[model samples]
Target: MMPLSMVASGETVRLIAVRGGRGICFRLAELGLVPGATFQVIQGSGQGPLILAFGETRLALGRGMAHKIYVESFMRGGQECQNN
Candidate 1:
């Protein structure tokens, strides 16, 4: 598994776990980042920030912050859900 920050542009991944204190964990959860949730890396600013989409919301996160969020890469057509 790679940290969410490591996800490349246009790549998709699944939320596996979060490594951080309760406050940071709660912050991520409130942003719709949770176990099993899938998201795509829309863009990554060279400095550190990344833009991601989960469900219908788009969020931007810094690399230092994203490193605390662990994720696993998912291939296209790996899993199907009623929603896209």
Candidate 2:
């Protein structure tokens, strides 16, 4: 899994894990960032806050916060990338 900040814009990813303290996890969970949640990266340029789209909802997360969240990027059709 890679940090959410590393994902490129327009890429869809599934949340794998959130690394941090309980407070951080709770905050992310409140924002609907729980594990297994699938969302698209609206903006993740590795600079500034990363914007994520969850269906009709969009959330702007700081780079630090994004770094704490790990996700697996999808290739297409919501399929997970296979290691080669």
Candidate 2 per-residue lDDT, tens place, 1-83, comes to 78888999999988878888999888988978777789999998768998889979999889998888888875533444332
User: Predicted candidate 1: what Cα RMSD to the true structure?
Assistant: 5.3
lDDT of 1 by residue, 3-51 (tens): 7777779888887778888887789878778777888889953666899
Q: Candidate 1's C-alpha lDDT?
A: 0.77
| Top of the candidates by TM-score | 2
The Cα local distance difference test for each model comes to 0.77, 0.82
Top candidate on lDDT is 2
Candidate 1 clashes between residue pairs 3 or more apart in a chain or in different chains? none
| Over 4 Å off, model 1 | 76-84
Per-prediction TM-score: 0.81, 0.85
What's model 2's TM-score? 0.85
